[model samples]
Target: MAQTGIADRAARNGHAADEGGAGLAGRLLGGLARQVQQRIPAADLDERDPDYIRESLPRQWLLASLWFRGEVRGLGNIPESGPVLLVGNHSGGNMTPDTIVFTLAFYTYFGVERPFYQLAHNLVVSFPQLSFLRKFGTVAASPENSAKALQAGAALLVYPGGDRRSLARGLGLDRLFRLKVLPISLALPWGINVGDFLGHIPLPAKITVEALPPIDLREEFGQQPDLDEVYDHVMRLMQDTLDALAAERRLPVLG
Candidate 1:
């Protein structure tokens, strides 16, 4: 009888362990699903409407041109056709006016009919109310989406990853894809538009964006160049341009 009871107890514990494991797995999967839902909504592409962009240009232009007194130079430097990658600095902390100014300049110059897309942070794209962004070809930033846009021969705008990563991609991707990497520089409002993310009154601070000459990576850095060497070259080139822009600024901080 004692032996039989011990065996029964052992079987019951084993059964409970299985149930506990299943329960734990269910919780983990449930948590992961929720995170996925909150972070990466299954909406990478397929919402861009040329008509919507055309209709919206007037409003965006008004804000960019009138309020910010924005100026974008070197739009013509961008190739008139084909897949082009625009990589620029995110100068404004929460209120990235450079993006708006550049977008307006691109659309007005190229016309809304040409396909142009920008990769946005997941936090920005996940909001349901910001669905209008999708209409403007603003998709969640991902390698897959970037590749898809480029492969489709669309003008894709991407912010560099990080210090080292940014340099690596700025050149590496260009060499791999045979792209002309356009580096952008911007000077935007300071005080009034400081809290750009939360919404603040812009001071008409005269935002200026300059698109530097497109760098053909393989042509400039050679077909097989060291990433670190390429990075240093690009950094010096951008920093010099930034310094020049600052020197030309009338309202150094505000603009």
Candidate 2:
């Protein structure tokens, strides 16, 4: 009966299962079954699975507390309820330990039940082991996705550096002013700088992440809205905060 149910699910997902196999071939077929499961769009991910997140929280907490030693500030600026956009710089290349640290901290502080989502690149979403990301409320970065998440009254986290070309075009005025922009930073004391372009292993780094006050487009920019002005204001605020944090760091990775 259980085997029948598995076969039915595979058929519904447009994947055919091989019933006949043994040893290496059976193992290969089992691997394919798992891949098919990952590819199936079981849910639209409009809201996160709080139970799944709760189940996974302990491991994430351990990493955040012991491995990264992450500290988050200005969380009070985040409203207890309502939609808000969190914009931050991207650091530490492909591995992006900073994102992991911030995310775990955010969920811990707010509890897993809160409707929160993080925008990520499609590559990251499609990558292996990251399939669980969707369950934890990560969506591929897109204008439509962003609008949908906000409309649902969920807090959204976005990294401008994650999409450099779009960010550059949108914030061209900042470049013209030669503004110092810092989106995200990771301090590694072990001297293992695992940048995206460099490698994958993350060293034990004391990560500190801060969340700025929420910005309401309708309230701050009015109904009409000034895109250029809004862009400049956000970048400047982030840059100022980055400068302050940098000042406090006496050495690399020690902060």
Candidate 3:
């Protein structure tokens, strides 16, 4: 209790000397976030170019088809209009083939004119080499950007992996954004790649994606349902789908 009081007082004091060495992390993360925000400004939403998407569809499709040999199903289940919350798993390190496949599928099915956005890591959006991703509606994964995309009636795709807090935030998103939670599953038979920068990647592998039926929070869960229950249900549903996908794989990347 004494230590707790000291810590509380330190926080209340808001002095670097009183931070108990907590200021380093805050400073580092803040600097990084600031640098990323500079590279990919909040106004980057306007960078979503329909013409660019239209022209790049063939290239993305070829990469998805010939390279990854990707296939997607149940995309029709998504509503034709309005905002949507696509929650799914992602793999393949920085060369995330699952996202590439899904991007092609979504653009072709919905048409380039439709507003669609994807939340990506700050590093991904901030990388100068990958700046073109912004043109494809890839925004830095932040609450403000997510809210803006939803407000713009854009379909938002999020891979809430390794972050239970993000997954739990679905409860608040449901209430505020009135967003429909669609549990999507993407399978990479190749498994995860650590994104080795020093060496070239091996031959392309197969990737399969499935968009499950949408979940209406109010209808599926009670009016004031428990967040934990919702999280468990979603997690279970995703895991089962992944297991089923894994079972079908006879080989690793060759599949």
User: Best by TM-score, which number?
Assistant: 3
Each prediction's Cα lDDT score? 0.65, 0.64, 0.69
Clashes of 1: 0
Tens-place lDDT digits, model 2, residues 187-224: 11111236453445676766777777666655675555
Q: Rank the candidates by TM-score, best first.
A: 3, 1, 2
Deviation of model 3 at 177, angstroms = 5.2
Q: Give lDDT tens digits, candidate 3, residues 76-133.
A: 8777788777778776466666777887888998899999888887777777888888
**Predicted candidate 1 versus true structure: per-residue lDDT over 114-186, tens digit per residue:** 8888877786776776778788888776655776777677888876646666646532454444433333222
TM-score for all predictions?
A: 0.73, 0.69, 0.78
lDDT of 2: 0.64
Model 1, TM vs. native:
0.73
Candidate 3: residue pairs that collide: none
Model 3: how far residue 89 lies from native, Å: 0.5
The positional error of residue 182 in candidate 2, measured at the CA in angstroms, is 23
Candidate 2 global TM-score? 0.69
Off by over 4 Å in 1: 1-44, 169-192, 199-203
Overlapping backbone residue pairs in candidate 2 total 7
